[model samples]
Target: MKHTMLAVLLAVVMAPGLALAHSEARPGAPADGETLSAPPEVVRLNFGGPMRITVLKLVGPAGEVPLARTDGMQPVTTLEARPEGELGAGAYEIEWRGMGADGHIMEGTVDFQIEP
Candidate 1:
């Protein structure tokens, strides 16, 4: 009975960490709902854990913008990208998918606007 109680206590203590194992993006550049005076040259994504970007995209009013690029497997907690072309004042959505060290796929989006 003592052993069982100890096991339950241990499980309860570790549950939160397990639940948070999945990587999640922290506050990123041009944070969601943020309005920028000038377009950001580079967008920075900060994750909770080391991650390898699998898919990244920037969608604007015009259409999909080819802004983000990665050479190869780069396991990093932060990923930075410089857009390919000039961005005009408008709303943009930054979408991303990444793989964490735990081998789980995590994805999310950040939306912001540029006001000139």
Candidate 2:
């Protein structure tokens, strides 16, 4: 019976790739040496599990850039983004915090540059 329980536990632990869960930014964003043609309108993230973004903020050079205010609050899943201004052509970083449906908080950042 112990061997059978061990087999079940091992399978549960090895299923999904946790390392690939929290993504940083949307595609086409500038990397370390990459140049972007246009500015991104909003910061986006792709999460592996269903989640609610408890906190999503775009931090600019100064301090914190305000997200375009929304009419109503809604539960978020999959890719999360703020309703806000066009990410102007410049250096920017996206800061985000999301909670998995299972209640774990997932967070990360992605940096990109926009060519003037």
User: Which runs in model 1 stand beyond 4 Å of their true positions?
Assistant: 1-14, 68-71
- lDDT tens digits, residue span 1-116, model 1: 99999999999999998878877789999898899999898988898888999898999887888775553658888888889877898999999998988899989899999996
Give the TM-score (vs. native) of candidate 1: 0.82
- Candidate 2, residue 76: Cα displacement in angstroms equals 3.1
**Highest TM-score among the candidates is held by which one?**
1
Lowest summed lDDT window (length 10), candidate 2? 23-32
lDDT of 2 by residue, 1-116 (tens): 99999999887886665545543333423333345687665455555556566666666555567775341234354453463555566767766666665566777666666777
RMSD to native, candidate 2: 4.7
Each candidate: RMSD: 2.5, 4.7
* TM-score per candidate: 0.82, 0.59
Candidate 2 residue pairs that clash: 68-84
lDDT minimum window of 10 residues, candidate 1: 64-73
